[model samples]
Target: MSMLNEWQDYLPDFLDGLVVTLQLTGVSLLLGLPLGLGLALAMTARRPAIRWPATLLVEVGRGAPALVVLYFVYYGLPQLSLTWSSFACAAIALAFTTSAYTADIFRAGISSIPVGHREACQALGLSHAKELRLVVLPQAIRVVIPPLVGFCILLYQGTSLAFAVSVPELLSRAYSQASITYQFTATLTLAGLVYGAISLAAVALMRARWPRRTPTITAGATRPPEPPTRTHPSWETTSERRER
Candidate 1:
């Protein structure tokens, strides 16, 4: 069969795999985001005991490759008597990586909050938790959202790594089909196209939804419209200038 025709035939299986891929992405994000926020808060805590351990976890997670983490969860954990399903293993590993990376993002967002705001909260006799819940976090959430969304896109693409653990995601399905048809080129090409199409569509939608805000220049915004050229100053008219 022609490659295009073959692609059409294989599309159904690929779509099934895509569903699994989305599920994995959603699960990882669901589990990771709150943990990431907690890590961010801990890393920013005044207590050294709290901050140190969370910092170490963030470092190790960020430093390790996702494949290694996946392998550790899927393979090493079994020996340690913590066996989990392949899907669960993949989700946990990916979620760990997600939380680690996102912790820094959350930290940056939280740090972006002005010190004056914190001081104002303190002056109002707000507890630390209340201040974060009411004032800091609300503002930080807005700052973090765009970056968080971008990271989510990265996480979605990274889900293909589950193929190593045999979780049967999009890439795994493509490889399975390629092995059977011996049409590696055609099968993989279709998979790449599928991934690219989804990613590009997401990017286009993100741009449409959150278009960059260009500064709007009104008539007096730049230089006060040159103060109307002062043809006849209110305090000194043309006749007054002649008299002077």
Candidate 2:
């Protein structure tokens, strides 16, 4: 009963923090996904000049920890005369991390396409841009959807790291509440349960929307033979005379 009352008192603060967390996740994904797609495309460019730099960026983004990136954006950038609010800094840092990690996922989806599709596009005289727009991206995006959803869940959880920079997100709110009431276990446990609940719901939604697989032929099942072709009259006459 005391716990119920305590939760009622804490609910408003937690809801406010959740709003901020959702905003951060939405903004980061909106900005980062397009950047990640561009980087994925660049990495696949035929020119070494375009590919190398993009590859380097992706590698660094994946290699560096998200917390380090957040700190760098919030603390390190001010040294260079670039300054922003804590919220802005957190959004920027999270977006950078999202782009770096999602780029690989996008790249894998793009690459999984059969080479024959691109070849057919080329044979049809389509430009590279047209080929990707008309033939490639449509297919790749379908492959990427599930993994992208999973990544967004991770990024949402990662928003907790922004508490270090005083962003007032979910974890920060829970921490503040615990610090004041000295009910660390109950408050933090509630915060954790909130995060887990949302994550599980997202995963369930993703599974529901996931593409269904088509059935494939089993081993030992032979394909039907090709039909016989009819010989032309001209070829038949020439061959008959030569035989005579």
Candidate 3:
């Protein structure tokens, strides 16, 4: 009975925090995914000048811990005369992390294309840009949908780290409530259950949306199997007669 009352009292605040959480996540993905795609392309560029710097950025973003990155954006950037609100800092930090991590995912999807497809495009007189635009990317995106969805789930959970920067996300709300009511266990348990529920639902949706078969390298280009060879009885009899 008391637990029910506690939930009713705190649920509204947590929901407000959840709204913030979703906003932060949406903003980060909107900013991050395109940057991630660009980084993936840059990392795979033909020139070292383009590729090396992109590689370094990807490495640093992936190598650093998420909390450390958040702290760097929220606190450290102010030292360089660059300042932002806690919400902005959190969004920027998470977006940076998202771009770095998702770059590799995008790169793997792009690279999974069989070399033959690119050569075929070249033979058809398509420019590299056209080949990528018309052929490679469409297929790569289809191959990558499942992993991208999985990454989004991770990024959603990772928004909790923004609380350290005082972004008023879900974890921060739970902490604030716990501190005030001295009900750390109950408040935090509810917060965790909420997170779990959303994450599981996202995973279920991804599984349902994920393609059942491997996407073909190119549309309408599946190769048919070769016909089996068979010897006719007449041919076998002729051969036997010649042998006799």
Q: How many residue pairs clash in all the candidates, one count each?
A: 0, 0, 0
- Where does candidate 1 have its weakest 10-residue lDDT segment? 224-233
Segments of candidate 3 deviating more than 4 angstroms: 211-244
Per-residue alpha-carbon lDDT of model 2 for 1-244, expressed as tens digits?
7887888899899989999999999999998999999999999999999999999998888777788888999889999999999999999988988888788888877876677778889999999999999988987787677667767887888888889999998999999999999999889988988887898898788778774453232353243211111111111245433432
Better by TM-score, candidate 3 or 1: 3
lDDT of candidates 1 onward, in order: 0.83, 0.81, 0.82
Report the lDDT tens digits of candidate 3 across residue range 67-126.
Answer: 899899888999999999999999999899889888888888777766678899999999
- Predict model 1's lDDT versus the native: 0.83
TM-score of 3: 0.87
Ranking by TM-score: 3, 2, 1
What does the lDDT read for residue 49 in candidate 1?
100
* Local lDDT at 10 for model 2: 90
lDDT of 1 by residue, 101-178 (tens): 888888877877767778889999999999999998987786677667767777888899999999989999999999
| TM-scores for all predictions | 0.86, 0.86, 0.87
